[model samples]
Target: MARTLKTQVCIIGSGPSGLLLSQLLANAGIDTVVIDRKDRAHIEGRIRAGVLEQGTVTALEEAGAADRLHREGLPHDGFELAFDGDRHRIDLKALTGKTVTVYGQTEMTKDLFDKRHADGQIFFFDASDVSPRDLTTAKPRVAFTHGGESIIVECDYIAGCDGFHGVSRRAIPADVLRTFERVYPFGWLGILVERPPVSHELIYANHARGFALASMRSATRSRYYVQCDLKDDIADWSDDRFWEELATRLGADAAANLQTGPSFEKSIAPLRSFVAEPMRYGALFLAGDAAHIVPPTGAKGLNLAAADIRILSRALIAHYADGNDHHIDTYSETVLRRVWKVERFSWQLSTLMHQFPENSPFEKRMQRAEFDYLSGSETASRALAENYVGLPLD
Candidate 1:
């Protein structure tokens, strides 16, 4: 017989979104069980985006998961936009009175896992054949195999924080699901090195060759990326070649200061914008990469996930506290409003900073014109700054 357990909420996937939602709900006296297909080591080993919006920081603080983040995360007031061999700075803090924290997603996930583990929150890693049933009914249950034994979790609600490729989103009926997507022509070839970053603040460069970004995980660890053909082989990009290309794209001053090192981690990530409408289908609500994906140019992927957690956590708390369903009823609509805004911003940034192969002379001139305008106009810079630091969560 399958062992049975009960919880107020069943969280699927152990990524940052799933862990964060579990943390918030657990803090509110709601019981949660998290299940993921990967082991803890593999889950925390994945390197991801590091920029965190202030709102995300707030959410982490509320969940009691920000203590380490606060201690180690770097705060940035502005970032540089480089084009035509010149750099234009967007003062995020001055423009929006908010700053972003540069803390790797891996670190944040580790923090969440530690907090959850300490609280004795149940987790089933290496879970197999996980399925959500009766989502339309009040008593939804998730069944999966763990430790060579079948187990079932009965819950009042289910939170599908599993990613885009996960099973949660697929569980929603195709007829009810609507998706919007735009896949870019190129991908980002990123490298993580044991060296200091060229710039103190992040730099997004639009070069004649392509787009390049200078980012860091800490004072001693640097992460850099250069745009490349989607089909480009990772083996073709050795340490010297990547650093040489990166320095060329960043121009003279930054290039002169650039430090080269062997990459400990190197991977190429495709760029795309995707969103599934009505993030909720009955009791199975989607969150994070399971529902949407934004190009990394705007650094909105993880921030968007944190936003979804805030909305879902509040809605679940209301449902459990006083049996109020208003928040739950309107969760999808509320979250999507912010999601779309973020999508637009990501699209705009990607277009602005990346080179397109199909661009005509006229198109090239238009791109330059926009860059010049942004460089000259404080208002335009401020607008970008506001979006970069993240717009207020509604």
Candidate 2:
């Protein structure tokens, strides 16, 4: 026999987007239930993107998740872009009046998970799956199983925060969906080293060979990535080989203070961008990667997801409190305005940094020339700064 429950909102996935949205709704006295297919330990242990834009920090602080982040994270003024043995620094404060903070997604997830766990307010059903049903009807449902028993949840509204591989996006009818996509020829091979960072600030390197990024998750944990052919084999990249490649691409003339440690985590992230219009269909609304995915080149994946939830949380609240569907009806249109901008920015960053296959000599020259222009031109650097620190949330 299946059990049934009720809430004002049903959120699938306990990621940053879902958990944060749940927190916001719960703060407003709205009942929300969040569920994820992964267990608490599994979710917290995964190594993902680490950079947090200034706007993301602000949002997290407002939502009370910044307590742990502030204590452990470092604030970075800007990043160094190196090409052909020449380096040019873009000062984020001078260019955009904002700076990005270095904080890993794992830490953020742990903070949000622990905060909710402490309050005992937001219900996160980890190691669970919630399925959507009857979206076109007045009463929608999320069915799942927990502890060997099936459970069904009824909600007035459903938030599809589950991400690209989630059920929420699939629940939306195909006829009502409009999608835009861009796939890249390369992927990022990343590793989390146990040693300290090689540099004080993050470094983005564009060598004739490929692109590399030097980043940090904590004072003791450094993160790094190098562009690779989409089909490169992880089997071919042993620990020694990985460090050698990284040093070659990112190592500078000056001693980089770099050290190699056993990489606790290693993985490849395929580059792609996607968005689905009208983020809502009937009582269901989409937020975060469930609706869009940006290439990791710009570090916008997690931050954009957070921004989507921030906007959707307000819309969901208005619908329940005042019965005003204005925001809900226009949700997709509203978010896409910012979404397309990020898409462009991510694409630009990817092209400027990565060495695409099948490029002609002229195209290669154009890429290097673009790099030169960005290095020397105030407008280009400022544009990168604004997008990197993040655009406005409202």
Candidate 3:
């Protein structure tokens, strides 16, 4: 016979988004169980986004998950844009009256994981062959394997934070779900080096050859990325070649002070904008990457995930505690309103920063004109500030 468990909420995956959602639901006095396939070590080892917008930080703090991030994270008032060999700075604090913090996703995940693990609010490393069914019925259940035996968990609600490749997205019925996506011709080849960053603020460099960004994870560990063909081989670019290309695109001003160490990790991420409608299809709710995704150029992935769960947590509380489904019923529409706006903003940022060999002269001129307006015009800068900092979440 299989073991049976029951909870008010069941959350899948243990990334920053899943773990944070779990903590918030737990703090709300809901009986929640979080399950992940990977162990603690592997979950914390993966490197991801490092920038957190002001609204996201505030959301985490309100939910009691921002203590460590507030303490250890480095706050930046602005970042820079390098174009035509000149650097232009966008002062986020001055323009928006808020600051964006630099704290790697790993650190945030580890903090939330540790807290949940200690309190025994999460049941991880016991997930395998998980599947959810009959979400429209009164009784919703997730079946999986644990300790070589079948396990079944029944919950009043389910949170699918399983990310882009996870099984949650596939479970949605094709006819009912509508998906919109735009795949880019190029992708980003990212690397993390064991040396101090050359600049104090992030530099978004737009060179004739390609696009490059100089960002940091810590005082000693720096993160960098360059645009590359969709199918470029990681092995083809040797260490020397990597440095040479990076220097060519982002090293004009700091030729002498720039020093790079051995690369600890490398990855290639394709740029795309994706959205799946009706985040809730009855008892099961989609959150984070399971719901929508934007290009990383705008640094909106994690922040958007955090925002999604804020709405989710509130709706769940209202439904279970007060028997009010008003918020729950409107969850999908409310979140997607912001989703489309972000999709537009992210697409604009990507088009402005990247070099498209296929673009016509008129298109190129329009991009340059838009960049110039954003760099010099105060009204234009404030509009950028509003989107970059984030829109208000109800």
Estimate the TM-score of every prediction: 0.99, 0.95, 0.96
Instruction: Estimate, for each residue in 1-394, the C-alpha lDDT of model 3 and write its tens digit.
Output: 9888999888888888788778887887888887777777888898889999887887778667789997888899888877656666888889899889989999888888778877687475747898887788999988888779988889998899988887777788998889999998899889999998888788887777788888899888899898899899998877777777888888578545567777979888889999998788888889899888899886889999999988888898888788999989999888888888888888888888888878898987887788788778988888877788887775
Q: In model 1, where do residues sit more than 4 Å from their true spots? A: none
10 residues in a row with least lDDT, candidate 1: 385-394
The local distance difference test score of model 3 is 0.84
Residue pairs in collision within model 1: none
Model 2 C-alpha lDDT per residue in residues 1-394, reported as the tens digit of each score: 8889899898888888887888778777888887788777887887777999887888788778899889888999998888766788889999987888899998898888877777675454553566799998999999988877798889998998888888888888788888999899888899988888998898888877788888888888888898888798887788888887788887565126778889988888898999888788888888888999999887899999888888888788898889987878778778888988998999888887888887889988988899899889999999888888898864
True lDDT of residue 45, candidate 3: 95
Which regions of candidate 2 fall more than 4 Å away from where they truly are?
122-129
> How many clashes in each candidate?
0, 0, 0
Which 10 residues in a row give candidate 3 its minimum summed lDDT? 251-260
| RMSD values, in order shown | 0.9, 1.7, 1.5
Model 2: lDDT to the true structure? 0.84
Q: What lDDT score belongs to each candidate, Candidate 1 first?
A: 0.93, 0.84, 0.84
> Which number leads on TM-score?
1
Regions more than 4 Å wrong, model 3: 254-256
